[model samples]
Target: MSYLMMFYSAFFSTSVSASETAATANPMRSQVVADLVEFLIEAGQYLGMKLEQGSMSYQLFALGSIFLVAFASFILAKLILHFKVLRLVSRSNNTWDDCLMEAGVFRRIARIVPGIVVYTTYSLFFEPEDKLYSLLANFSAIYLLFTAWRTLSGSLTAIENIYSRSLLAKKAPITGFIQVTKLLLTLVLIFLLLSLLLGKSPIYLLSGLTAIAAVLLLIFRDTILGFVAGIQIAANRMFNTGDWIAMPKYEVDGEILEIGLNVVKVQNWDKTISTLPTYSLTTDAVKNWRGMTESGGRRIKRSVYLDIHSVSFADAELLEEWEGMKLLNQYLKDKKQELVEDRKLKEIEETDILNCRRLTNLGTFRAYLTSYLKKHEMINQDLTCMVRQLKPTEIGIPLEIYCFSKEKNWVAYEQIQADIFDHVLAILPVFKLRAYQRVSSHNEQAQKNAQ
Candidate 1:
């Protein structure tokens, strides 16, 4: 090409001089993009095609170049990433790169290349003062804005996935923070996109919107409250996904499925879903069993009613009978020693039951229960374990058992509680104690006697 150009220049020096003068004489041609376009038009003239600056053909060529630039740039960017970068990312051992690729971060980033082509090469396709430039620039601005927004969103997701691998994620999850950032970015981008469409400054529109601040506040009241609640919940580590929360007011007794800005979803024990406003968690009282679960124990709080008349001081015969029962042998010995020492110190008459400290059926039963709970394998001995008698009600005296079960799971914990109560109910008669039960009808009396 250089040799041919030299031969042409030597043979047509006069013509070349005349052409150079004509080109240099024109003041309208300054930029390299415009000069290159003019050179293409002149070359088209030699090829039997009419391409002039102010003609319809020039306009058609410019429009055609816009389409070609946009389509080609977009397609080329996609192909490069799809065939090269994406394939490599997919096969790499490093998982973070794969996360970005799957989140569409890299894909959206590739699209920016096309935007750069369309935006920076504006003069190559259209004149600076052309009306088409406004249209093309606006289109590119919107596209770039959307692409940038998507890239940021995808990046946030990738960051979340990366952060989730660490142990601190459960203690203090960054998901709520990430969501707030994403929401703020979305709002900002929306304003910018609208401003580009309407040919107005975003700050101007934002200032004008202040007049309707009250209306917007009313419209987004719940959202604003929810946002505040979400931040507090996350910062304070109030609750998290998979936490067992019981909110009686909402009839929510289940594991949390998700925590969002405006709502929290809980999957109930029956598999139904309950959605509560995020702000409700902050305002309402909720029982979070996460502490119990983390402690590896579940509380067992229950009371058994016993016939009041059946409770009495143990006489000699009763003590002799109870001596054979191994569970009560040590307890009886301990109490006898304690009462004898106390009675001698106070000079109380042993014959008088009121003056002397003697073992009662209720006291013996309470001691037996406390010892039983302490030795039970299913009970958590390291934690609070006690069996105390509560105040007598209209029916009978209430024997309350408060302890912790080793099992934290709902089903297993319930089974442990039931087994303990069932055994206690069955053995009550051994201590001459009867459970309080009211016969609702004659048929109920017969059925109870038969059982």
Candidate 2:
């Protein structure tokens, strides 16, 4: 092995000068490699074997030596990466290095070591004009290219992970961009691989690609559309990871798990995963709730239908009873004074309840709800908050509460909403109101028989 090292070093030193010659088109066609093979054959003869230049014995020894050297180089590179590079990365305060480590960028780079070692030293084992030499060269080149691809892909992944931690990532993600770059990298790798395999220039092969451009387009139609959609989504500051988006067209209603080049993954509320094409996000109607999340409020728009038969004007008894309530006392007192003054000015009699400015139970209930919501701890007072009646339907008059909740979390918001409706339904009877309930066939028959 010591002699072998000396041979390699001396071979490289001489090959540098020999490579400058016009006749030396291939650097692997070295006189030093020829000398090394002759030395191996002589050594084999000294061992009392019937050895010759092209003998199986000499070739086996040479091939085994190449494997040993390539394996040693690979192990050395891996050890250096683990002890030196990884140690430094682990100690670094910056998170990006950790991301790179996790992405296996260093590991992928280490895999190139064996290919490089084999490429430089393989000529020593066989004559440059031998078929084995060409085969080894091709294999080494392909191995290098493949390892380079892995390294570059890992680098891109590390880049995306680093960018995801930035504040800008929440506004505009780069995952799609990273994926698009990977796709381009793959295409380039394929072109280079084809050129290498076919023994042609990359540019020559690329020129031929123009003839099959339509087929390529059809094959990569979604990929091409996704790239364009990704650009639009990023530039326009569209939805990002963790955003709750609803694309009914795709039956997707969930928080975005990932946004990639070709697809956007959403984890639906039912815990089912939905995958939508990236282009579909741009072309289809996707409702992004990022605005609500960023605004620190989640809108709540719901209706409580009150049985129309239960609604009536507030009588003197009802007003007096509501005056003792904390939420409605001041409101009732203020309205009473305003109404008394208005009636006196208009010369209207209090006996005429319709003409006189008296409060209805529905109106007073709306005011109470408004005041209650304004003071509720969980509701966002800064945003729109109101309670009003909707047009009476066959079933009932809908009292709609339109407001936003301070809690933006799904579970918390749901709990807050539930709490509000619970309070509304429980307190409705106090206003002499009843929630509309559909009559069952059994109850309808009983009612009809009683009537």
Candidate 3:
């Protein structure tokens, strides 16, 4: 094989000068390959078989040489990169080289080197006008297209992996974008490949494709919608991996598991997996809890209905009982003094509870709630913290506790909220207040027991 390459090089060296002179006198056809085949046929005849030019022996030898050349070139390129270049790249301190390694960037690029060698060297082993030349050329082009596809795919993988480590990835994930790119590339490669195989122009094939437009649309309906939707979702930064989204229509109330081109996977809190169409995310309503998480607080907006009949004015006994409460001492003292001053100046009758100023249990309870929440460590004091009264319902007046919780974790926030309501409900009797309870069969039985 080494001697053949040397002879082959020497023959091409002489043929080039002869071809220049022959071009002026006659046609400079590649007879060098023909002469080489003759020499190989003579060599094969010396091995006891009668050989002839264009016979099975000569054809096998020519094909074998081409295969051997391609295989040898590919092995050499791969070994060099594997032993020296890629090994060194892997050991480098730079983060990008490591990313390339994981994406198989070097391996994909190396695989193309052999196809390129074969593409350029095929003319050397076979005559330019030979039947095999056209076949080899088409095969080489196909190889290049396939290898180029892999190279681009690996490069996209590297880009995605590198970008994912950045801070912006959390706000806007791009995995779906990368997948869409690969899908488009695949469609283009398929078009180019079919055109090459059928010996048709790409524009001709594209024109022919329009005839089947309805079929293609029906087949790729989901894929087309997903591709378009993936672009919008990624570009708009609507949702990302780990973002908690609540889509009631889809029964999805959990964080995103994976965002892909055709599907967006969500792992529900109930441990079930919900697969949503990528386009549906843009079409449907979704509640993104990302704002609450990023804002460092979760809203604790709950109401405890208070029985209107239990509300009463604070008399001497009730006022004394409220005075013993640590949180309401200052408030009660100020109100008492204010009432006394108003009585002395206005000359109003103190016996009339409605006309004159007097504290109500509901008002004192609201004050006590305000003071308790302000001192509570779990409540977000930086935002609105208040005990507001809503309109009276058929049940009772709703005393709503509108505030934000410092603990944002689901379980922790629930425990904190429950602890607050527990204390409030237990001490309501001391303030002559009672929570409204809806009538049930059990509740009617409990009323009978109380009677």
Models 1 onward score TM values of 0.83, 0.86, 0.84
lDDT of 3 by residue, 1-451 (tens): 3453354233323223443464446433446545666676776777776766545565566667677778898899889988998889977988777888899988888889878877766655554455676677678878988998999999999988888877888878888789978987788788777867776656677779889999999988988898888788778888889999999999999989888888999999998999999898899999999899998678988999998878988889998888899999999889989998998888887887667888899999999998999999999899889999899999999998988999999999999999999988988998999899887574588689999
- The model with the greatest TM-score is 2
Clash count list over all predictions: 0, 0, 0
Best by lDDT: 2
Estimate the TM-score for candidate 3.
Answer: 0.84
RMSD of each: 9.9, 6.2, 6.9
Give per-residue CA lDDT, model 2, range 160-246, as digits (tens): 989998888888888888988898888877876776677775556767978999998999999899989999989998878999999
Error at 192, model 2, angstroms: 2.0
The per-residue C-alpha lDDT of model 3 at residue 170 equals: 88
Better of 1 and 2 by lDDT: 2
In the range 134-205, model 1's lDDT, one tens digit per residue, is 666777667777888889999999998877766777776666677878988887787776766776655567
The lDDT of model 3 is 0.82
Question: How much is the lDDT of residue 212 in candidate 2?
Answer: 99
